[model samples]
Target: MQKMAVLLSGSGRTLDNFHSRIQEGSLAGEIQVVISNVKDVLGLQKAVNYGYPAFHAADNDEINRILADYEIDIICLAGYLKLYSPPEKLKRAVINIHPSLIPSFCGDGYYGNIVHRAVKARGCTVSGCTVHFADENYDEGPIILQKTVEVGYNDDIDTIATTVFAAECEAFPEAINRVNEMGIDFFWDRVAK
Candidate 1:
């Protein structure tokens, strides 16, 4: 089974989703650790509540050391706001879930509710989520999976956000499952072109 270490900076909704999927036998992996950049965050509390090894660290070196110690196979950024410079060996193993279709309402300053608001401001007819490889840049990695949701004419930011989040809950785990099943080589090969 793949051992996952999640990095988060806000509520643990994504982590909670993963746990539920794992418990239901849909995800073939276990959360080995949860590292939060900020203390007193809901995500950290959830990790502790779940009995998972949880740590709060703002230093990259310390975070890297903790990741190495856990022998993690996958690193997931679930609402993690800080920029992460993962060790070279972990480059291909890290993935993040973005709230937009990517290359759209994504990049620096385009996280959380901001993305939804952007979509609304642009009057987009469709909006969704993307799960992709995590690179040094924000949401600029090769897309692994995208789940689109229609944006109704009257949809407000809250409605759009709710819709996109629902898609994320499904797409993120499916992307992880795909990576686990096909291996990283397949992912790289498919995106190489």
Candidate 2:
């Protein structure tokens, strides 16, 4: 089974979801460590509660060291707020789940409720989530999987967020499974020159 590491900066909803999947044998992996960028976040508490090695690290070098020490096979950014430019050696192992479809309501300053608000304000009829390879830029990398969710005409940001998050709960694990099946070589070949 692939050993995984999760990075988060908010509520541990996504992390919890992953843990549930892992425990249920739906996901072919184990979460070896959880890292948060800030202190007192629920994500950290969730990690601790689950008996996972959890820490708060603002430095990329320290984060990289942790990943190496754990021999993590894949790095999942659940709700990590900071931009992490993975070193070349680790690039193929890093992935992130974005709230909105890439190249849409994504990029810097687009996260959490902010992304949902943008989608609702645009009067969009469709919105969804994307899981993709993590690179130096925000939400710019090879797309692995995307799942769309319909936006009801009267749906407010909160409603839309709830709907999309549900989709995310499904999509993220599916994407991770696909990535695992693809193997690390698939990502290595697609890495930018």
Candidate 3:
């Protein structure tokens, strides 16, 4: 099984989803470690409860050390808010699932309910999720896969968020599985200079 490291900054709903998928034998990866930028969040607690090695680290050096120590094969960014600059070999190994489609309500300062609110304010009839490789920038990496959800006019932020999250529940895992199957060399070769 491929080894994975999950990094998060919020509720860790994605973390929980991955755990469920793994337990159900849908995802073919092992979560070697969990890192949360925020210390007292529910996601961190959930990791501990699930018996995964979890830690809190905001410093880039600390994060890199943890990743290196675990010998991670893939790094999944679950609602992580920081700009992660992984070393060249691991650059293509990092993945992020965004709440909104890339080139849409994504990039810095757009996350969680904030993205939903922007979608609502913009009156977009469609909103979805994007799973992509994490590069030096935010939401600017090569696209991996996307799943769309309808956005109704009457839908509130919570409702829209819930809908998109449902799509994410499916899309994120599928993306992770796809990446795992392709292996890290697939990514490295494509991005090789």
Q: Pick the candidate with the highest lDDT.
A: 1
Candidate 1 Cα errors over 4 Å, as ranges: none
TM-score of the candidate numbered 2? 0.94
Ranking by TM-score: 1, 2, 3
Kindly report which residue stretches of model 2 are placed more than 4 angstroms away from their true locations once superposed: 187-193
Worst 10 residues of 3 by lDDT: 184-193
Which residue pairs overlap in candidate 1's backbone? none
Which one is best on TM-score? 1
lDDT string for model 2 (1-193, tens) is 7788899988999999999999899987899999988888999998999999999888788888777778778899998989886656677778899989888999999999999999989999999999998878899878888999999999998999999999999998988898878886675577676
**Stretches of model 3 off by over 4 angstroms after superposition:** 184-193
Clashing pairs in 2: none
What does the lDDT read for residue 44 in candidate 3?
92
Lowest-lDDT window of 10 residues in candidate 1? 184-193
TM-score of 3: 0.93
